[model samples]
Target: MVKKILIVCIGNICRSPTAENLMRDALNHADIEVASAGLAALVDSPIEPTAQAVLEEQGHLPSAHKAVQLTSQTVNRADLILVMEKRHVTGVLGIAPEARGKVFLLGKWQEDREISDPYRQGKPAFVHAYALIEEAVHAWAQRLVG
Candidate 1:
């Protein structure tokens, strides 16, 4: 069984954090850990407001999450690293090539999809992005845990 999961994106304030929370909620009963990080994170910044609002609307709380950077240490710790886009895979591999096999697109197990970033767009865009992340995370939880 996969004990640890790391979700990755660009800012860590949007997509990855949502994915991480969704996965955590779905796998609440499972003996696994879930976290999130960014390739170009804001270091200790809080999650974006738009992202937080969308999550709250969906009954998921994301107000306490702070952005974290992706590092070799985090990469090494995760049993599975689920990225938002294809470039993230390359970027993570560049940081830790040994993590190659464990890294995968969060949406890959579903429809070979890519979850687009909604960084500075607005509330609507963030909502759309959250929907995508929610689907991907739920699918992952089912496949990996259920």
Candidate 2:
């Protein structure tokens, strides 16, 4: 029954945006709207180049993402908010205390694993993160659709 989903990470230019686009592609549920934001956003920054390249290599079209800061209003709008790390969940709660029930780790089903930041770590790091995100996205998609 989740009508809207928000993916979150620290910067929005890496993990969150990657997960956002992948989830959008995987879900295919017309009623579910997916978006992303950063706890401490870069504000107007695009997806990190290495991250974008990893996504493209995996056949996921990178969206025209502009980094956005997470706000209470954004949290309220999402029925579900998937974050990249445990700290991000805490950060989101700090923004919207009432969002406690809606927030979760993107890797919730994958042993609660956290997707690490790959900002300046180059393509290898981005590739590793991409695999994790893709796996998590599929897990979520199955649960969401089933």
Best by TM-score: 2
Q: What is the C-alpha RMSD of each candidate to the true structure, in Å?
A: 1.0, 0.8
Q: For candidate 1, what's the RMSD? A: 1.0
Per-residue error for 71 in candidate 2, Å, reads: 0.3
The local distance difference test score of each candidate is 0.89, 0.92
34-114 per-residue lDDT for model 2 (tens digits): 999999999999999888888998888888999999999999999999998999989999999999999999999999999
* Per-residue alpha-carbon lDDT of candidate 1 for residues 36-118, written as tens digits (9 for 90 to 100): 99999998988888888788888987648888989999999999999989999999999999998999999896677998989
How many clashing pairs per prediction, in order? 0, 0
* Candidate 2 deviant stretches above 4 angstroms: none
What TM-score does candidate 1 get on C-alpha atoms? 0.96
TM-scores of all predicted structures: 0.96, 0.97
**Least accurate stretch of 10 residues (summed lDDT) in model 1?**
55-64
Off by more than 4 A, model 1: none
Query: Model 2: which ten-residue window has the lowest total lDDT?
Result: 23-32
